[model samples]
Target: MASITPWRQLLLDSIQANKHLRHSEYFQLATVKENGRPANRTVVFRGFIQGTEKLQFTTDARSQKIEEIKTQAFGEICWYFTDSREQFRIGGFLNVIGNAETNPLRLKIREQAWFQSSLDSRLQFAGPSPGIPCVKNGPDDNTTPKLDPAEGPVENFCLVTLEPQEVDYLNLRKMKRYSFVKTGDFSWTQRELIP
Candidate 1:
């Protein structure tokens, strides 16, 4: 089994400490656009992959972020925990497990992510294509209808996994910070940073 990094432990602790807040699970994901500009949006953290440090998230394939990720596989996630007064900026590579994914493990994870999502969340994948101009009284203008859970993941539903390479952790209350860089498969080198 692979060892867990200290930064991962810190992040998990922060999550636990701030679990009461609904937004604690949300993070800002930033990706490089085709024109060299940065694109960012709030995404919910699904959880870490079992036995791995990778972070999991769900996305619609029709979202522009998918194209941005395909163009530049790297992304950075900025997560802030309110109650804990801490933040973590995680830099990593994004892996998309789409409808065409063939890896059994990845496919299983993707399906599980879909099934675990709320019905409203699952229906979003079946709605109109994201990022397109909304038409009056169109699908984009209203909440998506409920979907059957047993139908499984829609074609547009994707499981996004981020394999963290570097992480910057900051504790506002303590006025301290640290930078961690991956040194091996399951190890990292941590350095204290001036807050």
Candidate 2:
């Protein structure tokens, strides 16, 4: 299906392309740590929320990124497609969803995700929190954690969403680029940029 707008199409492209990608999400996420330093990591692309201004990804609630997001809601996603020699950088406000206080839209997605995720995936979040050191490394241990005895949705599952305030798309093959800045709610002012 063709997208209604170029901006939507670009984002949709990223979401659709993520499926064939394994080594990366066809993008990278940059979040600011509480210490005012930049931290970049790879995240799987979930999808854009319908009739809204957000992109989604799943993460362990215990991940350090959660703390960073709680401190600062600002973040960016950089998407590059080698096949098309194109790059799309999206800067926006980020929010972590999947709790009692989270809105229903995100809650619904998280609910579906919980059901689809494998037992092994759920077990990951049930273990020690991310960045906490342990005597034995997970891979070296030659054993994986078992699912919690209760056998329910992992308590740590969360959906991370970004609401874009700016989108910059560049096409190296054509030597051109454009920038779109949010002008108002669900609206943006676009401009061609010097590539």
Candidate 3:
């Protein structure tokens, strides 16, 4: 089993302390577009990959972020826990696991995410291409098709993983802050920072 880093432990603690708030499960992901512009969006945090430090999230394959990620795989996630007045900026590289994935483990991970998603969540992947104009009653109709929760992911559904390289954690209430950078496979160097 891969050992958990100190920052990961802190993040887990923060998640437990603020589990009651729905927003605590959300974080802002920033990526650089092909045109050299930055794009940001809110993404729900899926649980970490088993026996790994990678963080997981789901996204539509047709979303603009996919192209952005292709242009630049490096990105950062900024997560804030309101109840705890804590924030974490995690910088890392992202991996998109889609229908074309051939690795057995990655395919299994994608399948697990699909099965774990709610029916309504899975239905979104069946809808029209995302980021396109929505029509009242045309092909863009927002009606969701029935999807079996146990079924595997659709073509448009992708499991994205973030491999953290650096983390900056801040606690507002205590006026304390720390920065951590990955030093080895399971080791990190932490430094105190002025909040």
Candidate 4:
């Protein structure tokens, strides 16, 4: 049996214990042009694949992010655990979950959660018809709509799979400040830093 390093074990523990990190927002940075100029935006993480060690996210087929992914398969995702004062950064190639005909299982879970919450509000936003604007910046600023979780568009969503080849873990502590860079499949190198 192979022995796992302490840092590797800690990293896995943090992900497993939290299941999802709050401060760490998932974003995909992809190259748009040949010059390598990239575009990035925040994305919701669905879950992580245990066996393959890949992270999952959802997006719309019409979204620019999807186009970026198509043009450039490489990207990076960052997650900062505020409560734990730690940051996790992963870099890898992205693969779109094809089969547009079939609804994604991840989206199904998200849809069920949204449906159970506020049927009316969600239906209004996600319905075939357009929804009313919820936000008002000024007397005439009716364009900005307030976010209604219930009114999310389910059909417009699609899943993105990110299989990380490298991950960097940074722990922000006055003492015992540590950073671990995991390269390749399952190997990692730890470095101690001055806090």
Prediction-by-prediction clash tally: 0, 0, 0, 6
Candidate number of the best TM-score: 3
> What count of clashes does model 2 give?
0
Where is model 1 more than 4 Å wrong at Cα? 137-146
lDDT tens readout by residue for model 1, 1-195: 567678988998898999989999999999999999999999999998888888999999989899899899999999989888999999999999999999898899999999889988998888888778779986557675567778989899999999999999999999999999988776789999999
Task: Kindly state the number of residue pairs that clash in model 3.
Answer: 0
Q: For each candidate, what is the lDDT? A: 0.92, 0.76, 0.92, 0.58
Residue-by-residue lDDT tens digits, candidate 4, 1-195? 335555546666666656566534444444454456767566656555434566776555555666677778878876655656666667778876533535566555445434443444444333332334444465544343344563544554445677766666677753455656656466767777665
Ordered list by lDDT, greatest first: 3, 1, 2, 4
Candidate 1 clashing pairs? none
Ordering by TM-score: 3, 1, 2, 4
Q: Which segments of candidate 4 are over 4 A away from where they belong?
A: 1-12, 15-35, 101-156, 174-195
Could you list the CA RMSD of all candidates, in the order they appear? 1.9, 3.7, 1.3, 6.9
Worst 10 residues of 2 by lDDT: 1-10
Q: State every prediction's TM-score relative to the real structure.
A: 0.94, 0.82, 0.96, 0.57
The model with the greater lDDT, 2 or 4, is 2
Candidate 2 lDDT over 143-163, as tens digits, reads: 556775445456788878898
**What's the lDDT of the predicted structure labeled candidate 1?**
0.92
Instruction: State residue 87's C-alpha deviation in candidate 4, in Å.
Output: 0.8
